[model samples]
Target: MRPAIIRKPAEQSVTPNWDDSAAARAAFSWQAQAGELCGLPGGGLNLAYEAVDRHAQGRRRQHVALRLLDRNGGRCDISYARLSSLSNRFANVLKGLGVQPGERLFVLCGRGLELYLGVLGGLKLGCVVCPLFSAFGPEPIETRLRIGEGSVLLTSEALYRRKVAGIRERLPQLRQVLLYEDNGGAVDTPPGTLSLAQLLAEASDDFAITPTTADTPALLHFTSGTTGTPKGALHVHGAALTHLVTGKYALDLHPDDIYWCSADPGWVTGTSYGILAPLLLGVTSVVDSGEFDAERWYSILETQGVSVWYTAPTAIRMLMKAGAELARRHRFPRLRFIASVGEPLNPEAVWWGQDVLGLPIHDNWWQTETGGIMLANTLAMPIKPGSMGKPLPGVEAAIVSRDEQGGLILLGDETVGELALKQPWPALFRGYLGQEERYRRCFVGDWYLSGDLARRDADGYYWFVGRSDDVIKSAGHLIGPFEVESALLEHPAVAEAAVIGLPDALLGETVKAFVSLKSGIEPSAALHDELLGHGRKRLGAAVAPKALAFLPDLPRTRSGKLMRRLLKARELGLPEGDTSTLENPR
Candidate 1:
C-alpha cells in the first residue's frame, strides 16, 4: 500500500559490490566468474581446491576460515591452512576406505568441525557429497541414502546408533560408516563403525585433490515433492562460480567482514553460501551449532561483529514475535547487511527490520534445483516489500504460458504465468539423479519451468503468487495463497498462516485459511470473527477465505516453508503422500 522505500547509504557511506544493474549485467559472464577462482594446480576445476587449497596457499592461509561455536558453548577457529590440512586428512581417510571418485558420500552430522571437513574432503576426493539434515527422522535419511546410492556415511556415534543403525541393512551400497563424537566423546563407538578421529589421526595431513573438470559432480541435494520419491538435484564443481558471484552481489560479502549464514549444511543455501561462498571469498564464516534462540542469536551478531547475516524467514518471524524490545537489548553496530531466503518474506517483516533493526531485509529468490540465488533485492536497490528483485547478472527470468501446440508464450508485465528461466547457468542442476522423465517434464525447451506462478511488474520486480499446484480457483477468480497469507500476517495477533483450497460443489473451490496465533494468545470465537472480517477488508470477499480455523501451529518443512499440499490433503481426507519431510506430521 505504500510506495517503494528508497534506501539510502548510511552516514558512513556503505559501498555495494556494484551500483548499476544494467551495466553489471552487460559486463557479466560465466567465464570471467570462473576465472576469479584459481583452478586446480593443473588446469581443471575442483570446489575444494578453489575454496580451501587456494586460500591456504595464499595470503589468507593464517586467516580464520571457519569460526565455530558448538552447542555446548565451546569456540574454535579453523584457518584456511588448518581447514586444508584437516580436509586433506579426511580425504586420505576416505581413500583408505576405498571410496572412489564419483561415488556418493553422505554427511549426516550436526554443524561442527567434522561436518565442514567431511563435505570439503569428499569434494577433494572427487566424491559426490550430500549433506542430510541432522534432525531428520530415520525414514527420510534412509530414503535419501537409498535414492542417492550412498557409498559412505560420515556421522556421529550417537546418530549412527540411534538413526542409521536400524536402516543400514536396507542400503547395501553403503559399505562404510565413519563415526565421530558429536557430544564431546560421551558416547562409545559401536561395533562395525570406524572412528573418524582415529582415522584422521592415522592418516597423513597432505593429499593431492583429485583432478576434476567443471562438469564433475560435487554435490547432490535431495528435494522432496508433494508425492512420489524425492528428487536428487545434482550439481557440479562449476557452481562455485555462481556461489562466488551471488555471494558478492546478493549477500554483499567483504573480506574484512565476518559473515554468518544461519542455515544448516543439510540445505543448499548452507552448502553454497554457508560453506563454499564465504570460503571462496576468503572471509571468516561463523558456524553456530546451537539451535535457534532469540537472545543467543542477538548475542552472536553483537559479540561476533557479524557484518553480513543471511537467514530464513521462519527464524525472522520467530524473532519478530519475540518483539523488537528484545532485539534492542543487544546492539549490533557491526551488522551492516541482513538478507533472507527460503520463503517469500511478508511485507510486514520487511518493514519490521527497517523500524527495529535500522536496516531493511533484502529478500532473495532461488531454489534447491537452481543451486544458487537467481533473483535478489540487492543492497544498492530500493526496497520493495514482498518482491523478488531483478535477476542475477548472468540469469534470465520470464513469465510464460504454454500454448495448445506445446510452445511457450511470454506474458506481459503484471500477467501471472509459470515462472521460467533461460537455462545453462553454471549452477543450474544437471539432472534429478535417477528420474529422467520427471526431470524432462520441468522444461519445455531451454526455458526451465519453475512450477510456480508469478508476475513481473513494470518496475521489473517479480511478485510470488502460488505454486501451480497450490493455486486456488474460486468463483472464476484465480487466488494466490500468498496474497491472503500476507494480508493475515499483517495482523498483530497472527504468528503464522497457511491458505489452501477446499472442495466446494457450487464455487468449484473455496479459499480457506489456518492460523496460529502469537505465543500467549489462545483460540477464541471472537478472535476468529475478527480475523474473518480483517481478511474480508484486506482482500475483497471473493478472494478472502470463506472459512477459517485456528491451529496450534501449521505444518512446515525443515526449511520453514508451509506444507500447503499436506493441509489440502488432510482437509479432503486424501492419502497423505510422502509426508517424510514434514516438521510436524502429527
Candidate 2:
C-alpha cells in the first residue's frame, strides 16, 4: 500500500509551541529545556507544586482544571484553587497518619474526585504515588503491593472487598487502608480500614508542598513481563518538563483548549497525560468515570467541546467496529486534534478518523521506561498514516544493530533494526526497582535499547515493525507481525487481528493469524479464502499468513493492547506466564 498522507488545512494548522529543529538545537538543548520548566522559588522542584499550587496562586486560579463526569450523567467542575485546597488537605491527612516522605502510596479506585485528590496530594507529600487498575484481580494486586512495599492504600469499599481484602494479610509492609464510602459518604467502614472522608473532615485544608529536587522520585509504575515478575519503573519530578513539552507540541494543547485523555490513570499514559500533562499545560480536562461505551464517549466529546483527544488504538478500532453512521449522530465542531498511543495505530484507523471524526489520528510512540512521548506526529507536521513521526525536539532516535562486541552499531535510514534513543531525557526512568543489573542491560553505552523493531523512512518518518521478539524468520525473510496484521485488517470483514509465528519444518516459522470478524458478518469458507487471497495480494506469499483462525474475540490488556505473546504461548501449549494484565484471562 502507498503511504497515506493526511495534511492539515492552512487555516486549521497550529503554530508549534517549541522552536523548530534547527532553532531548538541552537537555543534549547535537553539541559536548556529542563531549565524552562517551573521550579520552586527557593531551589528544588515538585510535581504537584508545578501542576497545581502554582496555577492556584496565579491568574488562572478560577480556571476549571477538571471536569468530572459521573456514571449517573452528572458533572463536577474543580477549579485550580479548589483542587489546590483539596490536595493540600489530603497531604495533611497523610501527615496525620504518620506516613513519612518517600513512602509508597498506592491508589486502587475508579476515576473520581477522590482519585485525583489522592494522586496530587500524594505527590505534594513527596510520596511515590502508584495507581493500579481497579479491575486487577487479587494476585496482580498482591504482586504490585509486595514489590512496591506499599505503605498506604486508597480505595473504595467495593474494590477493597472484591479485590484487595483477601490479599491484605499477605502485604506486611502496608500500614493502612483508607476506604472511601461509595454511598455518598453514608456507609460504615470495615473493621480494619479507616474512613477517608472522616479523616479529611478532621484534617486542616492547608499544608505546605514538600521541597524536593528534580531527581526526587515521584512515581512508581509497574509494567508486566512475559515471564518473571513485573518491573517497577521509577520516574522523578523532573519528568514534568517532558510532559509539558510533549503536551504542548504533540497534543497541541492550548490554555483555552478543552482536552480529554480516555486512558485510565492506572496505566502510564493515563498518569502522564490524563492527569499530569493537561494539568501542567493548564487546560481543562474531561474525566469520565465510566467504562467504554461508544455513545457515551461521543457524547462526552460532543457535549464537553473537547478540542484535543488522546486515546488508545484499541478503543479507536472498537469505535470503528460500531460503524461510522453511529458517529454521524453527533457533532464535534470544536474538536481539532486527535492522537493515539499505548500501541501502534493501524493505517485503517487513521483514515477512519479523517473520514468519520473529521481529523486524522496521529500516532505516537513511547514506553514505560521512557515515561513520556519520545516520537510523535506533531500538530505542525503532515501525518503519514501509520507512521510514528519524527522524534520530538530534545529526543535523539536511531535504528541500531548489535555488534559482535555487544555494542550498538547505528543503521542507515530505511534499514530495519532495534530502535534506540540517546538518553539523558528528562522523563527517562531512573531504574527498575531493585533490579540494577536488569536496568543496566537496557542501555548499550549512550543508547537506550527500546527492544522494538522499526525502520526510518527516507523522509524521516519512523514506522513500527513489531517487537524484536515478535519478528518471524521465515525462509530467510524477517517478517513483522504488525505488517501482516495490518494487511489482514484491510479486508472489509475483519474487525480485529492478532498475528504470530508457528513452527514449520520447511520455512522454520510461518505466519498465522487469529481474527475476529465485524458484526453481522458470517464466517464462511469463501470468506476465509477471500481473506487469505487478500493477505497474499497485499503482503505477498513470503510475509502473508499461511494459516488463519476465526475467533469471537482476541485477548487484550486492560489498556487495549493485543496479547500476541499469549496467543503464541497458548497455541504452542507452553506456560502462559504472568496473565495478570490480561483483559480476559481464560
Per-prediction TM-score: 0.98, 0.98
Give one digit per residue, the lDDT tens place, for model 2 in 1-586: 6465645456474555654466664565666666656688787999888888889989999999999999989998999999999999999999999999899999998998888988999999999999998889999999999999998999999999989889888998998899997555554677788889988889887887888888999999988545678899999999999998899878889999999999999999999999999999888999999999999999999999999999999999999999999999999999988999988998898889988988889999999899999999877777888799989888899999998999889999989999999988989999999899999999998899999999999978899999998999999999988888888988889999989999999999999999999989989899889998999999998999989999989988888878898999999999888889988786
lDDT of 1 by residue, 1-586 (tens): 7567677766223689867467777988888877698888778999999889999998999999999997766789999999999999999999998899999999998989999999999999999999999998899999999999998999998888889999888888889999998765644667667888888999999998999998999999988546777889999999988998999999989888899999989988889999999999999999999999999999899988999999998999989989889999989888888899988998888898888988788898999999999999988888799998888788899999999999999999999999999989988899998889988888988999999899999989899999999999998988999999999999889988999999799999999999989888888999999999999999999999989999987888887788999888898898888888777886
Q: What TM value does model 1 have?
A: 0.98
Q: Give the best candidate by lDDT.
A: 1
Q: For residue 145, give model 2's deviation from the true position in Å.
A: 0.2
